[model samples]
Target: MSPIELNKRQEEILQIVKNNGPITGEQIADRLSLTRATLRPDLAILTMAGFLDARPRVGYFYAGKKSAQALGDTMNNMKVKDFQSMPVVVRESVSVYDAICQMFLEDVGTLFVVDEQSLLVGVLSRKDLLRTSIGRQELNQIPVHIIMTRMPNITTCKKSESLIEVSRRLIEQQIDAVPVVAEEPAGLRVTGRITKTTITRAFLSLSESHEL
Candidate 1:
């Protein structure tokens, strides 16, 4: 979602905070010759948009912006486990028809295929299903393993990994989502997933956080 542009009063409030941070709302109100109630919404907007940080007794402090390096470092420090969503899975033996149905039911662009042991085996993508649908083969009879992106070719990540690294992989490979896996003795176990939407939500959530 696009951010709300600052209004004239909001801009003035930011300037005041930037110059003398940890300043109380009452002081700011006095300077503006207006009641604190009038400035309430403006203060909330600034804090919500990452422009200000307010403490219990310390008042509002300036958190206008960070340097590019600082911002990158902050993003890199974020973990996948903190942001990933639940994984959507299917059995490799399930028919392409069932996989496609499940994709639509779950509203997901990708599905992870697992074997009997519930270990990662392959992946089914929208394109993979579409290609199969165009063929003469029966969708219900054809197992997903026949059309899914198979082992050694499937991309996976760990919950302990960084979002930036996973995001880079997603961009380079042009894939929609990456399964967060756990390395088992026999195979990888799917625990969660990180998609383009997940990365985007992370940024938005970060802006709402107290950090700048």
Candidate 2:
């Protein structure tokens, strides 16, 4: 059913589950100022809608990984088979000048640096590009492979990894994006990207709810 079909009470219950699910029924009723009997129907409706799951001890939980349902699914369901878009990448041999141009043209803050085999080698950001360019380095000759962040140190997520984990890394590392990689018989392949903006937007949308 469409979101519009959800009544105010149902939405409120959803918000509660999203924020604090695995919460007990008594806790929900107390917070909403409704007795358990009064709240039961609303809870039942939401669960039936595929928006939540009622666990044995954990009263209820949002169906997706966290509070943000659609956003959570996108993060948890990272099998590359489920991602709708491919991530943008640049070759390690490219010039800093060229990388800067691409970053600006695409209006993105991060760029993935990869090898010919499509395995991710490093990550370059606008900061990295600008720092190198201020030294008046040759625009066409300086390869990004020199300054890019190399792996096994570079943070990455497999296609099966959760986006929430990726977002946490972004905040902790103060980076804008994480490369989504997939392991194949040939080796690891760069598959997609998870960005801070996507996670931020998903959470930011929650503020529109006034129920708290």
TM-score list, all predictions: 0.66, 0.59
Candidate 1, poorest ten consecutive residues by summed lDDT = 65-74
Worst 10 residues of 2 by lDDT: 203-212
84-152 per-residue lDDT for model 1 (tens digits): 788999998889999999999999989999999999999888989999999999898999998889889
Question: Model 1 misses residue 189 by how many Å?
Answer: 0.7
Count of backbone collisions in candidate 2: 1
**In model 1, which regions exceed 4 Å deviation?**
1-69, 210-212
lDDT measured at residue 137 in model 2 versus the true structure, 0 to 100: 64
- Give one clash count per candidate, in the order shown: 0, 1
Candidate 2 local lDDT, 32-123, one digit each (tens): 99988556545644554457788887688888522333534433543322231357789988888889998888888889888888888899
